[model samples]
Target: MLTPSLMHHLSIIPDFRQAWKIKHQLSDILFLTVRAVICGAEGWEEIEDFGHEKLGFLRQYGDFESGVPSHDTLARVMALINAKQLQTAFADWMKACHDATDGAIVAIDGKTLRGSYCRGKDKAAIHMVSAFSTANGVVMGQIKTDEKSNEITAIPELLKLLDLYGCLVTIDAMGCQKKIAHQIRRQGADYLLSVKDNQPKLADAFEAAFPMKVIANYAGDAYTTVEKNRGREESRYHVVSDVSHEFQGLICEWPDLKTVGAVVSFRQEGDEPPDEAVVRYYISFAELTAEQMAKAVRQHWHVENKLHWFLDVAMREDACRIRRGRAAENLGRVHHIALNYLKGETRFKGGIRRKQKKAALSEEYLADVLAV
Candidate 1:
């Protein structure tokens, strides 16, 4: 069969340039950009350079009749493409490429692209909220928000775009809103949302239900996990219980609030005076055992460790300064697309940066990743 359509999915993005004025094809531009980014191009100039170097390989997938577009043309095309359309198209591609979402832990979180801010326009750096399927190590979907405080609103929008039929969605304290919980249910998914000062009464209820005495004495369902890495040791103590009826009056506002839990983490790093202990609280629609709760909560950080960290470290995403029009957001999408491809291309047996270096040096390697 012909290489399946990464081309067809991206081709759906409407070309904004005047039809007759177009020199390089939109499909070519889009394909070239994604491939370039995947192979370690960090900016429009680098993308343009990659096109010049790999024009032969790119031609197999796209019509580069007029050859490569200039850096300016690439920037103009990407900066003007409708971001929402791009998001939907990529999401559809991700679904087709992987079938790992059933019963997965979908973690939703936000990260700020620190370098995208523009003092000239006085616009803040774009904050993107991403939904990641931890089990498969792939980004499911993402949406851009104007600020961190807007995560409460962004999570619902991102949720609407995901296929989470049997997944357990997990969010941090910022996503504890009732509307978010209800929306997750609407998406046919359960949720484990963190509780903090954002919801004072709910926080108070969890605090009361899981007192020191109760955590020390209660012999009910509980689980503990230990970790040791690089002279550092940590233990996670997970304890869960039914959302008591006594808190019904307080937590009634939260939709389908069925379980409440706590994770108390103790850590010691090479006898560095043993850092302060940390405690976190949570509420979930799913009635979870301490073990289930522990797994879901632990998996929730995949978004941070796998997606966001790789973007910042491997892709140097925060260092990119493409802050014009929709360029920053669109470039962010490019990174997500490339990251998914790199993560899914498991035969490479190396991390993202190494894969990028190898892909840059070898056309066969790039072809293998793009083909899959």
Candidate 2:
């Protein structure tokens, strides 16, 4: 089964000697935390209750915490746990789960912990930025914002904690900054960023300057498809050729630019199709090829469809309101860990939450998920 011992056996937790002196061993802590999450524990009190109620099973994983640590103790330890260490350990676990999966697209995006607003009624909500590996469907690293800061300030720090070599990193308009582009290039990875009104001049320039005339005539290998469902429809056309000249403006502005182009997603719904095509623009740092473009473009939604959607629907994270003394940040990590476990399951094809409940009731489900 995916027991605490499995995490102990496979995790990249540090071997510091003082770890043994803690009130609870590392394995027990991880086990209880994982189990508590699996059993629907939302905050510190829920985790404590789950651990206390399952003391016997927890003992099977390792020696018991002298008494289930109080909710505050759990929160204190979680806050004190080095985020970098936990990030490294999470990365190692993902490596074991994602062996031999090359050309995997690892999308990095920031999520705000909506419930983390702590300084009473007047204070701004605490925001945390995270880099999620859309390939393995796991969160690679996360960093919280300092006072008087935003995600733009924290994204670089989070990126530094991850090894992005050989991965295609995708980010939205919030990450369209030139400095962030340079950082991604410096790390030896490619990028596909959505360009929007935030960079008005750049967006206007690209939209006005694309090779519409030449592109229509010189079709080397074009791919087009239309998906119609429910009350909406999406039509996508990918035209890939030499985009180097097209990227000259961006290159002058951001030196990391190798190639760039526009990606247009036209959507229509109800009875009437819109007169003007709704187009979204994109810029890429990767080599332009028809096949490569299609693969990367389609896979980019794994960030939204797989990670964000799961968090909102399956984990019900949006309903959470646990904003007290590290509970918010720590619980978010716990949810990330649980989501990773669920995503790694090979046997289930249904919803993640249902699979989680099945895993809770069935040891085999847990075993397959935790198995290396």
- The TM-score of candidate 1 is 0.96
lDDT of 1: 0.86
Task: Write down the TM-score for model 2.
Answer: 0.83
Residue pairs clashing, model 2 = none
Backbone collisions counted per model: 0, 0
1-372: candidate 2 lDDT, tens digit per residue:
244434743355553437556676655666678767765676678789877776776675567859677787677666565555665566555444443244557776666666566566554565666667665667765677876877787878877867778677887788888888889889877888878899886677666655566444645656566778998887776665445454555566764565555555677887786445545566777775755676677777777788878877787777777665555666676788787777767577867888777866665565566552
The estimated TM-scores of all candidates read: 0.96, 0.83
Q: Quote the positional error of residue 286 for candidate 2 in Å.
A: 1.7
> What is candidate 1's CA lDDT for residue 149?
59
Clashes of 1: 0
Q: Summing lDDT over every window of 10 consecutive residues in candidate 1, give the lowest-scoring window.
A: 1-10
